[model samples]
Target: MKLVLEGIGHAFLGRAVFEKLDFSLAPGEVVALLGPSGCGKTTLLQIAAGLIDPLRGRIRRSYRRHAVVFQESRLLPWVTTRDNISYGLRVTGGKSTSHRQIAERRAREVGLHPNDLDKYPVELSGGMRQRAAVARALAVDPDVIFFDEPFTAVDVGLKRVLQDLVIAAAAREHFSALFVTHDLSEAVRVADRLVVLSEGGTGFVTNRRIDGRPGDRSDRAIFDMMEAWSRDPAFSELFDGERKGLP
Candidate 1:
């Protein structure tokens, strides 16, 4: 399946975060939407998902079988980890001993502990919650997965596991995803192609294809783009903002 975006633009409160944007994803391709905070990365994702409409352009894609991992986990506070994943499968009418078994199996696959399955969100660490969120997204078996900085709060060790899990999932189900993140290293780790938002409130793509698996974060190609973009005024200003941190 091909996910297409043409002339896509968005704004909020009369302020434009992005304008005249165009991008797309093919089946099993993982693309990153990289931008500074408040630059409409998330807003653009909403436009892509049809959760919100763009202010000035059209979003064309086949929906009806898509899932999203928001910046926030948005898990049910009252539900256990196991139940959370199971419930999502239920929402998608995906039910079976096989589905629950697969969900639990995937929970383990994502590094969630067996003991943690029955625990509530309140008991889990920030990274754990994010893992549960990923698990829920997995339960849906979506053709398209929209990830909105899904691993922001995680630690490096945990982050690598989460990142690998996503790549693994994409490979397993052959699902295409639009992953939004500020970390260039992370984008390089998982993205088949990377799209950068410009200071002029526009964006364009960088790569047309990545290796079979994600490239190593330390790969020479990855460093070149990061080094060049580090001095980018728009990116620099974004770094100067409160969200400043190394990628």
Candidate 2:
């Protein structure tokens, strides 16, 4: 499966967010979309997911199935954790033991305990809710999954665990991803390629292919790589005060 965005342009209230931007996501590849806060990363994800149409671009998608995990968990309060995780299946008209089994397996993979599946979203912690959201997305067996800083609300330890879970899932399922994040460390750890947006969200600053397996890299190794890239002359603008620099 593949996704392509050609000559994409968007604006809000006469303020141009981005214009004439071209991007693509190849099959089985994970691309991290990095930018400063409010730089239209979320907007880009929305457009790519077909939730909104770009005023000046055409989007082409070859994937038969796609799913998105927003910043918020957005689980239903009235449903059990397992039910919330299976929401995608229900929406797509998949009602069977097979779908239920997939939901249960995905929930477990995301670190939700077996006992926790019967509880409501309000009954789970913030991280648990986020895990359920991810499980729900994975349950749909999408060929591409878009994530919009879904780990920002979790604590550091849980954040890393969730990142590892996503990496493992992506590898096992061979699905592609467009991960929108401001955290350079997180981006480095999860992406096969990294692309940074300009400060005004008008264009791309850089597109770098990372070597080695991001999912297998140690945190210290990823941090060192991030540090080196931040100091590189080509990426200097990405670390300037106009944008959220690497940590």
Candidate 3:
């Protein structure tokens, strides 16, 4: 399955955010949208998810189902973790018993204890809540998942763990994803390809294919490549003469 955005453009508060933008995501392929702040990364994700229509664009989706994990966990406060996880499944007409089982299994896969599934979101730690959100998204077996800087609120250790979890989940589930982030290393660690937006957000600056699987990249290797890319003209030109450095 694939999602394609053609000639996309959007605006907010009477100001243009992006224009004439184009991008795509192939089946089982993880792509990271890396760009400066306010360059409309999240806007693109929203457009791709069909949450909002672009001012001018055509979006095409081959997948039957998709999901999004935002920066916040967005768990329903009144529901138990398991219930929250199964909400989508139920909405999509899953059988109660089967959805519960899937929710429990997904919770465990995302590093949440099975016993914790009955607790409310307020009872869990931030990382655990994020895990529950991930579990919720995974329970529906979506063909694609859109992640909008989902790990930004977590600690470094937890961030690394969650990153690994996302990569593993994508590999195992065979779902494509669009990970939007300003952090270059995080993008490098989690994505199979990297696409940078032009400074004006009018078009793509470059599209780079990542060399290896996330599991195959060591810390030193990631650092070296990130550093090298920071120096690459193709990477640097994305800034369009701005003194701001790649994060």
Candidate 4:
């Protein structure tokens, strides 16, 4: 396994978020974590990424490098897109001259135009900012990446494009990922396996392997799988409010 969480539990301000959660990720695998709002999916991803220490658990990570793409772009507004993309390299101590070269290469890989590289985050579109965010995470050449609902704010078309970018990048780079999202269709499109958290963040509801490879499934197939899972008893909590017409 590339990462493992054993008996993990965490709380904030004396309010428990989760308890005794055991999860693991294999090399080059993408796992989508699903749950209702406030179920601690992001918290768990943060724990796995070592952003926060669990109050009770043991986390074992075999990979040497990792990066996270947050729900918001979270880029530094003061910096140009080129500098933002290469920020990881700077943190890791890369030479100044090489930062620009590496940042441009990563920007190109994520479909950012060269003209956009010199612009600050305030000057870019939401999609362009997200592209730069993804590029920033990739610039470090991480072995593992943590995604916290990274596409939820984008339009549907742009969301799919970003999803494809992630799938292609993961395939080409062989990086494992833990993607946190509430969207089932997005999960089917991106993950090799889907793991759901139980209501109230008590524990896992299910951890099931997806039928096909991330990029191999057709749109119809992905939709069908999502439709079927929406009716599954194990996934009821996730879709119950929608079915009941509750906000």
Clash pairs detected, candidate 3: none
RMSD in order of candidates:
3.2, 2.2, 2.3, 1.4
Residue 190, model 1: Cα distance from true site in angstroms: 0.7
Write model 2 residue lDDT over 55-97, tens digit each, in one string: 8999999989999998899999999998888888876775578
The Cα local distance difference test for each model comes to 0.77, 0.88, 0.88, 0.93
**Top-lDDT candidate index:** 4
- Candidate 3 wrongly placed segments (more than 4 Å): 237-247
Clashes of each: 0, 0, 0, 0
* Error of model 2, residue 24, in angstroms: 0.4
| TM-score per candidate, chains pooled | 0.84, 0.94, 0.94, 0.96
In candidate 2, what residue range of length 10 has the lowest lDDT sum?
A: 237-246
Question: Who is ahead in lDDT, 1 or 4?
Answer: 4
Please write out the lDDT profile of model 4 over residues 72-182, one tens digit for every residue. 999999999999999989778868889999999999999999999999999999999999999999999999999999999999999999999999999999999999998
Clashing residue pairs in candidate 2 are none
Q: Would you give me the overall lDDT of model 2? A: 0.88
- Sequence-dependent TM-score of model 2: 0.94
Give, for candidate 1, the lowest lDDT window spanning 10 residues. Answer: 204-213
Who is ahead in TM-score, 1 or 3? 3
Could you give the candidate ranking by lDDT, starting with the highest? 4, 3, 2, 1
* Tens digit of per-residue lDDT, candidate 3, span 60-152: 999899999999999999999999999998777857999889998999999999889999999999999999989988988999999999998
Worst 10 residues of 4 by lDDT: 238-247
Error of 1 at 222 (Å): 4.1
Q: Which pairs of residues clash in candidate 1, taking residues 3 or more apart in a chain or in different chains?
A: none
